[model samples]
Target chain A: METVMLDTGISERGDMQKSRVKVGIKKLDLFYSDFQALKDVNMDIEEKKVTALIGPSGCGKSTFLRCINRMNDLIPGCKVTGDILIDGTDIYKENIDVAYLRKEVGMVFQKPNPFELSVFDNIAYGPRTHGLRDKKKLEIIVERSLRHAALWDEVKDRLNKTAMGLSGGQQQRLCIARVLAVEPSIVLMDEPTSALDPISTGKIEDLIAALKNDYTIIIVTHNMQQAARVSDYTAFFLLGDMIEMGPTTRVFQLPGDKRTEDYITGRFG
Target chain B: MTANDRWSSKEMILQYRARQKRRQAIAYAFMYLAAAFAVATMLAIIGFIFTKGISEISWEFLTSDVHDAGREGGILPIIINTLYLVGLGLLFAAPLSVLAAIYMTEYSKQGILIKIIRYFTSNLAGIPSIIFGLFGFMFFAKILGWSWSLLSGSATIAIVILPTLIRTSEEAILTVPAGYKEGSLALGATKWQTMVKVVIPTASPGIINGIILGMGRIVGETAALVFTLGSGTDIASSLMSSARSLSLHLFILANEGISTSKAYATATVLIVIVLILNLIAGWFGKRINRYKDAR
Candidate 1:
């Protein structure tokens, strides 16, 4: 049993054994208008590993993910004071270009949210905005993105059709494909499969497993089993506090913190 | 009354049931009568106007802009003036109102200022067209010193419909789903880019419907233009010049009891133009909606 319990959260894949931090947050506090949302929080997301942020409702997993891409700046009166560094660059610096940051940091939301445009165009929007409009070039980029997301075969024949016409699973895959089109370094998913059926959820889980080979993936999921199954590193949050963060297996098997243990054992959220 | 009631009897139940049926039939008849009254009134008016005036619709009358149809003017210049005033008024009102509406719905914060603006806009919609005319005459014609010119008249007329245009355009913008904006912005597109490329296109059907309704209101206007526009049949100078509209022309003819024949003909033309516009709006609105649904 002890031999089976690997300390660094690796059970199947050798990639999760060790890695340096990709994004580090230090003493971060967030406010929406005047209401405090996230308290002082410090954590590190590992490079080239799937990190699952698990918590009860309103525990700020979504907010924490949003901070990576400066998505909070879009909300009025949403203020944050902290240091969030991506690859040693202080993303919070005043001179940081959000546009370029967004290019590097991509996000997939809870809903599929394929654009009203055609499947190809929806995937092409990011590349086009970055000024890659040569027709043949765009086509190649679209194909590469779809292939990376594992959606190319299903949609290759119908790329000109509207993205809205796709099934739920297909649309979610399309959304993931959309993010891939931008060639981001990190992919943030906020309950990407929460709206999906079990089969769709399984497909996304498979996609996530494949995706970590290329991009650092951070997923905020309420499903504990999902976190256990897909994540290499799992951080358990309670009431906006990081209760325990370690190898996913350790956190689930023998949580150090009583609160984390209680939560994992189903005593309380 | 229930059977448990001591006051109920066999004969009384039958009478009551008959009365209830009669009452229901009377209610239904009342609705039918109201509908029929409206139709009958419209038909009567149409019958009277066409019977008395259709025979008098002549090319000479349409080609000429005679101030007194009994004397000399044909409607050519007056009709032209009406067209000029409408085109100019829409040009002035359409862009400003659409922009204002977009700002209110898309960009402006939903705070005190937005609430106040919405309040005034609704109030302005209720204000009588004559008051607008007076305001135009005093401010545009007199203050701006574009006195008795088509430009002042059209400007005033444009002001009159400004509230209507703004309110309708606001409704159009509001009808568009917030999801479209969210989806676009989340894709790293700027707010302005999202608005122009996605939001506006989705709301175009509703916005055009609003514009068409406002245009109809402008064409049928009489009391507003009477004071704002100079009472002349001459061709209007540019947008800045004074002008006469079809409704004003009809009002003058009907009141003065001369060339009453041309009034009905012009009225028919005005009705036809409105119907054509409404048809075109409906067609475009339907086409756009179908395209969106297909997506």
Candidate 2:
């Protein structure tokens, strides 16, 4: 069944000849103090597609994900020397507004972290931050984002209840709904399902599959099956280098690099 | 041979277990006795104050103003003056310390400057109240030309409690999970907006706890209020007018030997006020927690 889908994806890539790139990262080198984390990385992420970054622990996949939105600036003694562009605009430019860039590119963390607030407030927080003051407008945005994330029905009646009261899966879905509230063009997930149960993980994977139609998604995952299941394109990382990146079927079934083959074959990590 | 060896080993294990249980029992008894001693000491002090002061706490003694060096009348004016000091001190200290804490935890870089500021805060907490009184008298009453007045006293108390409030609030802000801050920032909220909306709201209960603790210190203060507020035993009509706090009034009465019972009564009132403040603080903390839960 997945092979059939992969054949369709190949024809789809050919049919959609434009293949517009949403994010262009070039010579992206990141250093935490004197220790380099990402070394001369480059990639062109297609618009409205799911790109999975799979690697072992401390392989710098998460670091690369954060660089896309300049979230790395929050860390002390961390520096970046490279160019990252979103839709042909240089994000690392001095004049770029980081807050605005983040609005354009949203992130979901490994742990489900909702503010100590009501579910409604958790969704409305981004819209409210951007100056949506009308109560009716906020309410509409909250409902719309929840519905888009497929969480509206479970929490529709208890919008005013605290978000922390929700189950772990529900909380993670709420976090996704929160990101959707801002209506960003791209979404970043840093192993968002690592902390969830298998059932919850499947739900989020389905949600990611649905989200890729309108939003470009870059996800970091340790689960190889998940990368093969959800992502249209997969990039394998080994010690801060992109070993191989291609269609998910090719990366899993016919890996190009020895390290990628070894890692995928359960030989060694 | 194996069966005989197993029997001897089992017997030794049982003996060891019995000795361990005896030691555990002894430890529990000693811990209970220590706790009892501490609680008993506090109860005894409260008992002594209640016995010595209960007779002097009549309606007349509560309602009327002090007369003849607090020997014949109520300490109403002194009580009112202390309230003014506490109100003003909190008005200044709460905002300043909370903002300072926010800056330290949220905005400031972790470097030598932060280390120095923290060192100074701990040192400030250690300074004796009498030294604070001297500083307030020289700087606020003399140099600033405010004289011995409510303004001077309130300002002194505010500074005296600022370090403690800041330290408590900093810890509170730090306790907020890093994930929440990162989550807010990822939603495109600016640093200030994140602090105000998410960080401050979560830390508020702890911040309020800190403020109330600072209030307790200010209310019980005697030496500082005596030097800066002038022990006037009169209601302060204006910010600059001389006044006396309950603690200072009690101190003056006891020192003069004019009315030891009146002094005890004033002490009792101070204790009651502190007790009420603590109850209110606890209730407020629970309400804040419930509000944060939102369920």
Identify the leading candidate in terms of TM-score: 2
Model 1 stretches astray by more than 4 angstroms = A1-18, A261-269, B1-80, B231-237, B240-242, B280-295
Q: List candidate 2 stretches off by more than 4 Å.
A: A1-8, A11-18, B1-8, B280-295
DockQ of each candidate, alpha-carbon based: 0.29, 0.68
TM-scores for every predicted model: 0.84, 0.95
Candidate topping DockQ: 2
lDDT of 2 by residue, A1-269 (tens): 12212431643246347678899989989999998999889898989989999989999999999999889999998999988989999999999999999999999999999998999999999999998999999999999999999999999999999888999899999999999999999999999999999999999999999999899999999988888889988898888888778878778777889888888877776
Clashes of each: 13, 0
For model 1 chain A, give the 10-residue run with minimal summed lDDT. Answer: A1-10
Index of the highest-lDDT prediction:
2
Rate residue A218 of model 1 by lDDT.
Answer: 95
Task: Output the lDDT of residue A58, model 1.
Answer: 86
**Interface RMSD, all models, one decimal each?**
2.4, 2.0
Candidate 2 lDDT over residue span B33-96, tens digit each = 9999999998899889988998899888887899998889998898888889999999989999
lDDT of 1 by residue, A1-269 (tens): 22124354375446554677899989888999887777888988889889999888888889888888888887889999989999999999999988788878888888777766799988998887776879999999999999988899999999999887889899999988888888888999999999999999999999999999899999999888888889888888776677778779878887788887777667766
